[model samples]
Target: MATASAVAAPPGEPVAAPAPVPELDLDRYLGTWYQLAAVPQHFNLACARDTRATYALDPQGNISVYNRCTTWANTVNDITGTATINDRETGAQLHVSFPGVPTQDRLDGPTNYIVTALGPDYSWALVTDPSRISGFVLSREPALDAQQWNRIRAAIETAGQNTCSYLTSPTTGGRGDIAPLCST
Candidate 1:
């Protein structure tokens, strides 16, 4: 499970965020983000390949999360979630939640979702938490080339995440196909 590293501070007092982007443009950030790589998580164990996440902004400024992945067992798995900005000033920290589960802040505390890095043209992004326990490499394309991967790897290190912890995720030949295959 992911945990947040928070320094003790008086209630309502200002707190600093770890490895968060200086600013975020939600309009540019919204849309499909393929999961190129990630730190292993129990919930994502079954996701053998083709993991993806789509984001949409609500009128209330909340973000809708649509996550999907292909299992080695040749099945499609998905879940819908929501992310609310934890801090309005930076727009880099967010709190996410799935149905029937407690919010990220409630379950893991604040700073559970942080935009650690972003591509210049919004082609890719790297998200991490203050704890550095969880992270994801997202891209507008279904797959990333070696050069892009290297760039993202550098960004991960810059964001204070462990570069060695990430493993590449497979894809449908960069087609972004969600269909399940019967056999490997």
Candidate 2:
């Protein structure tokens, strides 16, 4: 599991959010996002490089999720999931489940998700859940320029996240550079 130092906040007081959720413009947020960084989680262990996700609006008021990655074996693996807004009030919190596997019975169970921060153009995003159990850094491309990266790092820090714990994915060997897959 990934670990990070907890950000200091006033005791018994909720941390003030930087902004409020306007209606979630799903259309703007759609398309592919490269996994620039993430707090390690079990589900993506096999992913080696070129990790990305694509989203689309489904007719049933759900967000369709498609995650793909290059595995250590040089094979590609993909998984599909569906996400629904958990809070209509903000439309920023959501729950995502894989492949409709457990059917609809457990759809609303423990699949926690939240959009902690989003860039004005939807080019970048910081996602976390209510329990702070999951977090991710997503971008519109496989890599970001130095300036964009700095902004992302600053946002993560502001969100009370420990940058050191981010586990970057490995890049494919095509380029001789072994840049850190993700950086804070």
Candidate 3:
């Protein structure tokens, strides 16, 4: 999951845009999502298993983001962030960041997050930033059946990500709130 570099434009070339998605209902999307797999990032390199994110609506109508995971030696790590809608029409475009980071502006900047794919019943979701530097497969259940995994694979590819490149996150079997469901 890698998009054209945002600053790698060769003189006149236009930067690539994030993948498009249909309408999204943020209300229905607000809940806990287990991370099944992801394209590793430097910040999350220590997250070894049971990675999950929770989304809640604040009184200000913005999204409150809480992400947690277990690292080596059963260490738990968590962080809080905020998300805002960049495009009201689709409700699929957003920019999110933790407090104290510069460039918090959602507009005049990159709408890094795109809801590239979501399950019909909100059972799973595929997320990728505009830069495509990061990608994640999320599910409501800790474990996914074979059929569900197949669909997840398809969703990942649909969002311009390689399934083989994804490092499976342990949800059920690992030592954490949720055991590792998939193997590493």
Highest lDDT scorer: 3
Query: Alpha-carbon error at 120 in model 1, in Å?
Result: 0.7
TM-score of 2: 0.78
Candidate 3's C-alpha runs over 4 A off are 1-12, 101-109, 173-184
TM-score of each: 0.79, 0.78, 0.81
lDDT of 2 by residue, 1-184 (tens): 1223344357897654333245567778888888877777777778777788899988887888899998879899998888887777777777888854554335565436667677777888877766555567788866666777677666666666656656665544322232332432
Count of backbone clashes for each model? 0, 0, 8
lDDT of 1 by residue, 1-184 (tens): 1112233347896544456778899889989988877788887889988888989987776788899998989999998878888878878888888776544424224558899888888889999887677888889987777677767877876765556677667776673433211110
- How large is the C-alpha RMSD of every model relative to the true structure? 7.3, 4.4, 4.7
* lDDT, candidate 3, 34-143, per-residue tens: 98877777767888788899999988888998999888768999988888888889899888877755665332355878998887888988888876668888888886
Best by TM-score: 3
